[model samples]
Target: MSDVLQSAFNAFLEELKNSESLIRLTVSTLLLILVVAVSRFLLRRFIRRNIQSSEMRRRWLIQLRNILLIVLVLGLVVIWGHELRTFALSMVAIAVALVIATKELILCVSGALIKGGARSFNIGDRIQVKEFRGDVIDQNLLTTTILEVGPGRSMQQRSGRMVVLPNSLFASEAVINESYSQDFVLHTFSVPFLRQHEWRPAKQKLLELAQKHSEPYLEQAKRHFARLSYRTGLEQPVVEPRVTIQLQCAEELHLIVRLPTKEHDRNQTEQAILAELFADDDYLGDYLPRV
Candidate 1:
């Protein structure tokens, strides 16, 4: 009985030693590939079904899913055939080669991850980073896409043209999020008048119009500002609608109306204000130059 047991154990060891390791590795690799493919397909479907917001879904599908899938595949590969030492050395060599060969890409991707993780901006948010100002349309591992907006030709308006910018630029540049924390941002409009006109009535009327137009946003902004101030141990400024008149070009009176406005509605609000101003000549007649 002892000889039979020894013989069986030795046969088992010999079989393991003489087994075609390459064949095993190939089979394992094929299985890993198949698992990854199926997982990706199922994950995509699950994400689509579970994520309600289109923007959030796009981000998860494009960025998060790919990262998880890669990690899983790598883990399976290491477990299937490679020894820990061999895997560690291979990974270190790959990392070194990646650092040397794709330094810029690595920096950009890493910067993007940091920025995204910090919640610096989100899709549809208006952001100004460096010379590029636009609505964020897409964010990826290395780049953040913008639907450019502004005056110059370089400023691609919301005309669907996308500008892809490397995320590393944020490290060196100041980033301004127009719709940060709050949906509405302050929009100021300037109306020029002759210096001789009494500005009080016009200013009052402008303030009233601004309040009327932005009543909802003003209320919300005031509450948000108050909370923020309290949290930061600062005194909150009195939240009221107001207009300031400034002397410009030595002769013209610049009546500036500052009000809360949605980013997309800024142009519309400006046009509406101008239309209202023109429609009521009596209100604006005091500011007109004397013939």
Candidate 2:
């Protein structure tokens, strides 16, 4: 067995020795390896001597390794340029197959590029992509990590869940940047009541509560929306507190309250309004559903 293996290896070497392209490839591979290895060694030595902090040294080493890898890849492409040209048709077919196999990965990268080029959202920006809505905690080429903001939008608070979404989703789904308004936003929430209840008084009370809670920031929000409209050429939206009535069904109705509040105070402001409205049932006593 040893003798047979030795003979096979010798024959393989002899065949390689005779082929000019094979010889060039072999020589180029060794030369590239030697250059990368030496460069890496020198880089490590310099970094270790000059960089005192362990974290800085680690970062430098990582960057150096990445540069060396890029150099090795470029070197191989340059050395195999002629051979690659000879197999251009085969390469094209292989490339197509690879693309099909890695379609999601390609989409993810393309999505990331599109997001960056468009400046769709940044870290800390609350965004809604289809059913998933959250604040972007981290983002990279393949995925985005968000602190999940809802079991549903009715609760404008984090659900303590971390959702990692493929960047590819950005390509297919519309990304709504909720934080685009910056400091102040016109937020809306629903207050459900029985259809038999007095919705008129409830509506008036809700408007009063919303207006009271939003009074401090109402002027600021108006100014912000004014600037936003001027810059974006969009018609300025109404920033005052308002209540719109809607019938959820024959038995139930909803009072949708639209109010301007600080971006981070949606839940708090809603809670405050509801708390005051339902505190003693005196304000909405007739409207409250009986147990």
Candidate 3:
């Protein structure tokens, strides 16, 4: 009985020693698992320590961390126990297979990574990607979620349904990130003016109203623009609120008010300006342009 038990134990050890792939895969997996687990633990702790608000941004970061960890573990498994030549050949084969099997998916993921790494946009940013314009609510490996905006149900109201767009769209599409780098975007509202109404006074009044109503955003925009200018070696953008007058139809002028404010606050700002104008009723007087 003792001899049989010893023989069985010896045979088990011998199998383990001879199974090169199994041994290699097991060791590599264990090592990678440990490294990823420890690194992620540390990273999460650091993020919690530094980040003030634990919002959707933090959730996104956590998701990113998990993805990175998985990639790292898979990479280590591929590299371990394989000779350099073998690893290179394997990688080439895998790449070829991926191209053949999932070209579109690979493109989408690559585009998303590029967009995120380049800081082209972020969650909560108001952006127009191609024809879809909305506030970005969620961004993942393959797709981004947008809350639609525009005219009718498409324009003003936040569509309760979220739009999931492929990240690859950004590569071939023009992306306008309204809140990129800065919290405020320039919003322009145009009002028609009759030729009989004096344009200068209307412009002055519009400028004053914009400045008064958008004071907080104007100040914030100034600081944001200043920093961006210094970093990019561009002229500091003028954030002081103002209105421009344009002669349009022979019968009317266009009063264009440019205000610095959060993109999401555009409707509110427009309503406020109009309310103020209607309440005073003295700026344009009896010469108000036909609506």
On TM-score, the candidate that comes out on top is 2
TM-score of each: 0.55, 0.68, 0.56
Find the 10 residues in a row with the least total lDDT in model 2.
1-10
Worst 10 residues of 3 by lDDT: 150-159
**Residues 86-161, model 1: lDDT tens digits:** 4455456556765777779878977887787778888988888876788888888889999888754222246556
Please report, as a residue range, the 10-residue window in candidate 1 with the lowest summed lDDT: 151-160
- Return the clash pairs for model 2, or none: none
The candidate, 1 or 2, that scores higher on lDDT is 2
lDDT of 2 by residue, 71-174 (tens): 99999989877655645644565567668878999999989998898899999889999999999999999999999998887788999999999999988888
Write down the lDDT of every candidate, Cα atoms only: 0.73, 0.86, 0.74
Model 3: how large is the Cα RMSD against the reference? 19.6
- Give the lDDT ranking, best first: 2, 3, 1
In candidate 1, stretches whose alpha carbon ends up further than 4 angstroms from where it belongs are 1-100, 152-160, 193-201, 231-237, 262-264, 282-291
For each candidate, how many residue pairs have backbone atoms clashing (under 3 Å)? 1, 0, 3
